[model samples]
Target: MMLHAGSWRELDTELYSLTDNNTHVSIVVPYTAPDTVFEAVQSDSIRARVDLLLLETPNMWQLNDLSLACNFPLTMTECYPNGTVTALAVKVESVRNLNPKYLTLSDRSCKPVFSNDRFAFFSFNLNSCGTTRTFFDNVMVYENEIAMHHSMGKHQSRKGLINPDYRHTVSCYYLVNDTETMAFRTRPRNSDPKADPGVGQLVVQMRLAQEVSYDLFYQTEDYPVVKYLQQPLYFEVELMRSTDPRIALVLENCWATLHEDRTTLPSWDLIVDRCENLDDRYIVFYPVVADARVHIPAHVKRFSVKMFTFTTDETVLKEQIFVHCDADLCDTTKPDGICSGQCASPLRNAKPLKPTGSRRGIAADISQHRLSSGPIILSDSSNFV
Candidate 1:
């Protein structure tokens, strides 16, 4: 059940290792009832066919109706509302763009591999209020043996990842008015598609100004029953343009507090490290800014961002990262967006600038004192200019 992707040679090697004699394997995509979906896929009696399952929501089952397609849709339906698992008797065609093409029923033994940009997962936890959804932002082998097997949260307790002690909170922008007040100016304009910069043009421009932020939770529980401590998290902030449905480039900046001893902050050593480390119950604040000209498509429901985090262990740490505007109008105490911390002095007009050397790595000259804790001064004329 473990799935992987690569060139033909690499895939051949993997298949050889799993089943020495590479047989003519037919790939099947199944949906509905995750348990029964796996049962049909793992049956050894079904020779000559390798079963794949695409997990889907109940509301979207119509996509699995492959009775009319010429060939199996990109996905194969496993279990229907009835006891039928795989509707092989009826002609089932694969639907292109549907995901999770494979499933391994054996928990420890069968692992699933997925292709890039093909699939993503949503971990749903239902509470009294409603269902809160947490999305794992990628389609890859997420190493969560404990949770997968024991139904116990393991990723949250892992050591080197984001530990259990982080405060998790999200800030939102909502339009609050008197209960009886009527909102908005006019109905959306309708225009001909043939016209230039039609109604779609203005709609897209305004949507780009708003940015969204969300809190990440590794494990889900009822809102009232949860307790949180402070820790670091790997943040993946992406700008979703209205023109495109995909999540665009991910932000690279990250921030965390000093270690438990206040000696030094944790550093990322991997080729690409996303998680930050911090003390339990500690507070780390970082700012978020939007360019205001992000170039979005016409139709946008909510300009919201989705933040997700997972540890290799089972500890839950609550975290809060405040996002604000880059303008100088924010309060001095929580300057989430301002460029000049809380300086009240009238700003001097500086010329357009670029870094020349190593300083290029850290180019925001928001301070004249020192770049970091380093002793490099702005004007080393020893005496004040």
Candidate 2:
């Protein structure tokens, strides 16, 4: 008998069966797991993962996904079916990790009434009620790993890393933190007058967990001129994995400081794209910032952004970290030429949209965090975090 649009599919134990328990079938799927998302979640740093399937289905139709038992049904309008593809993501990150009953679906936020006792690759099929076909040739599965530990500690302290003698062959000074913490800064505190009287100071707190197994992407020691993004922007960060399922890698208390007034950059929307684990050494992380703008309309020349990384009870969370360096190293005349090469950037290819100035960084007005204007058009003055 031909399975109609609303017909339920049987258990699939064959090759394309995405569920760990071989629960249901998702017909017309082109690629299997490793074939598509292998490299994405192949990092040891990734503890979980789910496929972000980009799909193009029949015009003005919804998906008839029968992978899970009681899947909260979903329908798509294909409103602008200009050959456009919608998404049908699965919560496979918790595949074998969680009880089958608690599985999640991209469409249904609440648990389904008839959940399959297994894990399924978020798959979409033709609706039994409708005759629209769902085609997914190109797909992507993003990995979202989180830090289960408390705040990652700072290995380099201003007092501990200072040297009296310093010299340089290339640039005068080096950046305190890498891209990992590029968007991090602390709020202005009246207590420390000498330590950056106002805002715009990137907190120099490096988390020393090299052995913790998380891949990081940062430009060379020579930092980018602090660019401002007048438009909203998003960033990615790899996080340490959590051993326990209940504890999610969560981020909290995030805001940006304007350069001119040292005020907070209001948040219109902060989205946590993923909080699951992938089987990769490093998880691909992305967050959505609908509006990365200030409450006021004034154009910002400089600013500092701030956010934190840690584990919490929330199902969806993101992470970020930053650190400060010893200002004493800036003198360029400190001790046994230690600060010279220590602060110099290696001879690598020129950075994208390299800053014209030879300044240390974009935040020149502030203390050691020498920031300069660059291409990304980021909000400015003294942006941190």
Candidate 3:
């Protein structure tokens, strides 16, 4: 049958067999019959197409079978941190009657590392294999798709049966673990920050206090709502995958602006020179503490600022605020190092201190990484009513 204008119409008649039992009745039909209807469906990621067969009854409709569909199992075989990269392994069920040699990932040449008659296995770094990374609700998502391409052979050609190209795809999703490092880089001074390949990342977020003693702080929404001049906004900056016990995180400077463009006019300083801005009396810094709730390496820094808006000529510009911070990683084992300094007055013509020790035996130059969070909307207290 075919559907037309919200109604089903009988397209043609076909031969069928029926069986009746005391418990149930079954009807069997040939899938290769001329009257068989197959509906094309786009897979969840819209990266693949599937053909579905439907069977209709008196009161309901049911999917008959996915025999002609490309719906195959995609499983994560392994996911673990491997030094500078996250090692990942995935397996896909090979399409029946399709050569496994033609089955590969989005990068057409990325063939399966291992394969049998039924399943094809792939292994690579998470950053490889044509994986695309995106951020959703503060969580990093990594996605990779596998595809199978097949064309009918000349020997199988038949009248009215075209040898059309057949393409099937299935996608696999992986979330970045907290201990895994993301490939991100800090922007040059006075430029916009962006994600780049082959660099460590620092995650900065605005959080809400859940318990006393800073034991439990939950990340707020990407664009958090706040009350203007009535509440304080808390923030945290963390270095990803800081598994070494000797490493420490430091925030060298932090500021807020009315726009995502950091260089926009009318920026406000909350912290400068590793100290709270002297002009912002309401700014508060929370000491980094290690406990069951927080990670052991102490790669996190926290602070809070009372909500306020940028004002000019006594006119308040109640725009969403974007907070940005320059951070660095230091070796806490080094005595009197960059991380051990106390908040003091900003010095004139003073050079910024670099981290003193190595990480994982690699003596690479540690630079200040910049991270930003927000678009924090400050609503008037009266607006709540």
Candidate 4:
């Protein structure tokens, strides 16, 4: 669906890039094991799940499939042979903006119930190392707040991540409504000085991860810099594929920070037209060449696709699968599928409109794992035996 509401407003703002400190970060997705094992266990046995862990260190990163909820520790193997994570996935340098950074994550309850097509992305900070400051007020980042681990460690005396509270809302950001606007009513923080005094510096780090086919556009709320809803915005998009169907695409607004601040609204719009499934696709891998066929998720608002190559070797030939959202692939009948290139014409029935930047990726990498490891099921498997 296209949005066409007319000229847009611009907000004055500031942007800054954060430097990477060279540490590995891990994102763990847990799942259940298989039906075979369930047969041996009694009918009353508790269920177990599997964990798909994605680990990213400064120099290298890897994906591992581990079985959880089992009495025995099942060895988790490295999905990648060389243990090299695509640079695209690990090179996300943390950014620091003059404005306080916004931190947000998809709620646990919001996990895509369908095909894992929630356009999922999250922003966060890292404290892979122990702390290095000396004072109760030295904590810049909260246990789960958006503050940079670097900034927080700079103030505290005690070492190690001192998460005083984790139950509270860990993310210090808000989701922009579909109306295309974010209102930041900055009030004195809970740790503000004058009254509470010496609560350390409040620094937020910027990190964004989103699926392909969507363009995130930003404009301040205060300028005449109008955006025509009928035209597509310019952006730089990149994609990275893992051994599994889940891939990640990053969109960085190359536009310099505009100076206004009433309320800034950045928008992410689905740009691809539609799709037609031509073949049973496969993911290919080689030196630097990692590509996967992305399946059109059931609940995605928009779909788009781009191709990337890393190796000149033919071994990279179709080791993976991916979904494309180009115009040719997407038509009136298949509005959800995207082709690999830009659409030839505007979607005949759709128009572009202002959007509010928001949340959050893949399935091909999924099938490969299932095929290699046998079918995965978290529910009880005893009946099968």
Against the reference, the lDDT scores of all candidates come to 0.23, 0.24, 0.53, 0.23
Can you write out model 3's per-residue Cα lDDT over 1-385, one digit (the tens) per residue?
Answer: 2322123444333455556678554545443343332233234211122233345666456545343322323233444546122222222222224444445666766777776543366665666767777777646656666665433246644442322233443333444455756798866698767978796554434344533355555554534655465667777776665577677676777777777876665677667767876655667777776677567636777777766424445554455778777776676777576767436553333222211121111111255676777567766766653
Better of 3 and 4 by TM-score: 3
Task: Put down candidate 1 lDDT per residue, 1-385, tens digits, no spaces.
Answer: 2221221111233233333235433433233211111112111122122222222355433222111111223322232222222211111112122222221222323223332233322221122112123434432111211112222245443332322122111111222232576678766669645745644211111111111242332222321211122212222223333344231221112222222221232321111111112221121223344335324311221222122121113322133222211111112233343322322222233321111111112222221111011111111123323
Clashing pairs in 3: none
Best of the candidates, lDDT:
3
Q: Which ten residues in a row have the lowest lDDT in candidate 4?
A: 84-93
- Candidate 2, residues 128-227, lDDT tens digits: the string is 1112332234432122111112111375344333231211011011233335635667898978566546743222221221112212323334233232
Model 3 scores a TM of 0.39
Candidate 4 has an lDDT of 0.23
Ranking according to TM-score, highest score first? 3, 2, 1, 4
Candidate 3 lDDT for residue 323? 78
Model 3 residue runs over 4 Å out of place are 1-224, 314-317, 342-365
Note the clash tally of each candidate. Answer: 44, 61, 0, 62
The digit string of per-residue lDDT tens for model 4 on 125-202 reads 223111122223422322222122223334445443333221112311122233566778767777746664564321
lDDT winner between 3 and 4, please give it: 3
- The number of the candidate with the highest TM-score is 3
Better of 1 and 3 by TM-score: 3
What's the alpha carbon RMSD for model 3? Answer: 24.4
